[model samples]
Target: MDSTRTNKLLELLQTIGLQELNSSKLLSLVDEALIHVSAGRSKNFERLEFLGDAVLRLAATEFIDQQYPNLPVGRCSSLRAQLVSDRWLAQLGEQLQLESFLVLGPKALGDAAAQATLQADATEALIGAIYSGSGNNLEPIHHWLTPHWQQTTADVLARPHLFNGKTMLQEWSQAEGLGLPNYTTTEQSSRHGDPERFKSRVEVGSRLSANGFGRSRKEAEQNAATEAVQRLQDVGSEINSESPNNTPH
Candidate 1:
């Protein structure tokens, strides 16, 4: 690690509200954080995103379980989905002005198409960084992520009958006794110089039902499953609602 670069990054940290970080720990933290953010096709964010996701779900689950004891399981899952989505996280990052603080490769910075996506990725990467740097300290991250979660939760709770794509997809498959929807990752690219992309397909009943793309495979799979559920449910609802006597007996 370069001392000068490390110093520069430490200085940058203060601008992002980490005024209490010490140089030595910041060195290790920033090094790990950068490596994690820039890993794979910069795929490191995926793991951090995964960790943060788990944390977010657990936190949301605990909150709902304790507070909304009368809420159904589906509603709890819907609330969790709204709170932990990438779109909401990206909004939180923007509120924190996170884009200005990102340390990206020159190429990544130069691309217009990738700029929007970097915010979401960087946010997840930062969450990952926080977990790594702070020893999985939920307090700081919760402080950071809670407002975003709150707004999203409020929006979702207003319409408790609605289901998120992930939840809907799972329920649709279960209703059919489809033996659980399966995900197959078709492509994952994280080359150092290339933009990262993940592609996946969701299958049900030996049928390739949907395809999706994302900066991470998890995101892609979620999208694919969501699409599959939308299609499946629409079809199922139509079939179920048909008049029984009008149908072939």
Candidate 2:
């Protein structure tokens, strides 16, 4: 690692109150974190984010399972999912000012909009780096991650249906052998009655599950998917329950 780069990273850690970190060890760890993207190699943090995401989920699940032995599997899974979400991870990254350390190409620079994704990815990479540096000492890593992890878990469990409707709907569908639920969409950019908005419908099976109006396709799709998940969960509960005849042997 370049001395200058190492010093910058040390300053970042110090800002985050990791003042206790030995200079030499912290430098080594920063070097390890950079390995996720390789030195001057990648434009996106996808690969590192992927590994970090798995690590976060697994670490979170292990923590919750050990701490709340009586919690149902569904809630445990929900908590894990919440902790590992882009939103929560991004928030944690922002708290650490993780974006300042990102390695991005010139074309990607000046994109403040990219901060959310970059922060989320950097957060994961940091977690992966910590885990790797700890010699798999999940105990220390768990402690480091616990504050944000618990906050996310608590928020999710407090309103389980809110953050997890999509996941629950997908799981329910798969468990019932419904095959993968497919989404079909139709959009109209201008409507006689609603001139300012674009209207879209998302359908599953023969049912028009959601209606959304947005100015763009991406926004419309997000809105439609959100509503579609809600609709599925609303109708899927009783239908998904196993009857004596259909119960597994």
lDDT of 1 by residue, 1-249 (tens): 587766666665664556565456545555444432432343345566656566667666766665566666755665666666666666666776765555666666676556546666666666666656776666656655555565565555443223255555665567667767788875566642123377778888774389877666777787777677556556655212111111111
Residue 215 C-alpha lDDT in model 1: 62
lDDT of 1: 0.59
Per-model CA lDDT versus the true structure: 0.59, 0.59
Best by TM-score: 2
Expressed as tens digits, the lDDT of each residue in 1-249 for candidate 2 is 687888777776666555455457545655545442433563335554566677888888787777677766765665666677666777888887776676666645655455565676678877765655556456655767777666665555554445654454455566666655454445563432222245556545554367655444544554565576666656664423211111111
Each model's TM-score, in the order given? 0.53, 0.63
Residue-pair clashes per candidate, as listed? 1, 0
Candidate 1 ranges with C-alpha deviation above 4 Å: 1-87, 103-107, 111-144, 155-164, 188-196, 206-208, 236-249
